[model samples]
Target: MSSASRRRPWDVHRLPSAEGSTFLVTGGNAGIGYFTAEQLAATGAHVVLGSRDRAKADTAMASIRSRVPDAHLSHLPLDLADLASLKSVADRLDLDHLDAVVHNAGVALDDPPRRETGDGHELMFGTNHLGHFALTQWLAPLLSAAPAGRVVTVGSFAARSERLDLDDLQSTLDYRPKRTYGRSKLAQMSFGFELDRRLRAINSTVLSVVAHPGGALDSLTPSRPPVSVTTAAERLRALPAALLVQGKDAGARPVVRAVLDPEVRGGQLWGPRVFGLRGTPRCEPVPAHMADAEVAARLWAASGELTGTDPDLGFR
Candidate 1:
């Protein structure tokens, strides 16, 4: 396929019949996650809201129930910053099977300051990448039980500018918060592709897909500069740029499409097509390095050691 004409997963307003399916959406209490959960519930699917804050999860569930009246929804606590909490939440899940998992929780820090999580890794890398890594691994069995399961990891356009700093995965040296965030996002995408390869190799039924919101405007937080504001000129440019950015609803399309579109290929990526930034949902290719077999193998091993969950799951 031509690079520019790659087939998209779905257009706006196209959704699958989710009647017997169950979904788990992290950070589902607000923003794009909330809308995605609401839409799924509207289609008669049972949704489990995964949020760090219990109160927020309650509020989200109440809002959705108020709208759908019969929306099947529940809440679970998940604090990505703490591995112990991740494990606890995983153990408490009642579902024996999961149709899809959307890893939507993320943090965008302002600067390159060194911040550590409960697990002792850089905050962004730990929460954005490692946390999801552990959660997905724990949920692998449930996902594998489904006839056509999907694991959707949310990534970002910033990943294009990131290079895997294996030498300093934790950003222990020359740490820049933005770069670290980009690297973490790259890790999320890389993990999705790597998981797809593992599933294919083992002939497993699970499918893995990665997606980014492009430049979606966040509703839960105030608008902020992208990453770097080296000068007043850059700040000036952000003013109009934010205005032109796509809405969170449009941004959530890729995630929704990735999970619902039957044509979505394992290891495929979905995002906006306009300027490769913000627009409707479409399928796109990730950088070749993101799917490199050798790098993926190394990353899988490293992640297993760091997160205490194996990607291969003994299915070599």
Candidate 2:
């Protein structure tokens, strides 16, 4: 069979049944995260919606139930920007064994000026990179206990903008919104790949994977319980871009694939098949810098230092 035919076709409707599984999705209250949770719950998995606002999470939960009446759903208050909140939520998580944890929450392009959270860390870097780092480490025990646990950290096409700088991870030296966002995503991808290497070195079953949603448009996506009430100005801004992008449900395909596709190996990155914007999920090559073992190790070490939490890789 040709390489094309050897590739398995991935679609939201055809996901492997998630019965008897449990998954946690950060920022699952809106956008692509919400769609991912809805899809997983539809397949009989119990989904824990992690969000900063309980009300928004409740709204997202109601939205999921409206579509999938039997959807098994729970909510956990998680604010990735705040380490205290992240640890509190992580401690509160009662799952015995988590099948997967989708790190899908972060600051988007429209967010305000670069600012530090209460922890004195940049908002995007703290939430997108350091926040997930600490949470994953705290949850490592639960994950290791699972038969085949997986952690899926979301990345972005913007990561191609600038190479990661260990000293300027927060972009304090020079902070451009676009570049800062890209740097955070680069850190996320690097840490994810490095995590896979460490897990493999220790012969652990937990797999670390990275995925990007490509481009998704809020104007084109249907708002169920209304995670955020889109203003007229925002919708107008999204109009032109909406034509070139996919809806939230379609954008979520890559993340779901990364979580459920049995063939997906650790250290592999998945994204849209068409120009990194919108299409079916497919394995994509990680950027040369992002794939570098040395860079990944540096970021991993930096993450541990910044988060003050060392990863528990089931080895001394």
**Candidate 1: tens digits of C-alpha lDDT, residues 1-316:** 7854785535467566788899999989877787778778877889998987888788788877877899999888888889877666646887778899999988879775689997888898889888988888778878888889999999988889888978788889878888888999998899899988888988888899998888875432222122111355544555666555765667778888888877788989999878667777888878887877787778777877888876564333
TM-score of each candidate? 0.86, 0.90
Give the CA lDDT, 0 to 100, for residue 120 in model 1: 89
lDDT of 2: 0.84
Name the weakest run of 10 consecutive residues (lDDT summed) in model 1. Answer: 220-229
lDDT of each: 0.80, 0.84
Weakest 10 consecutive residues of candidate 2 by summed lDDT: 307-316
Candidate 2 lDDT tens digits, 1-316? 8987997676667787888888999999988899999888888899999988898899899988988999999998888877766656546888778889999899855554779888999888998999998888777877887889999998887887679878788878888887888888888888888888888888888999999988887766665646645557876777788656777778888999999888899999998888888888999988898889998887877777888885553322
Candidate 1 TM-score versus the reference: 0.86
> Candidate 1 at 206: error in angstroms?
0.3
- Looking at model 1, residue 18 earns an lDDT score of 83
Q: lDDT, candidate 1, residue 223?
A: 26
Q: What lDDT is reached at residue 148 by model 2?
A: 93
**Candidate 1 clashes between residue pairs 3 or more apart in a chain or in different chains:** 112-177
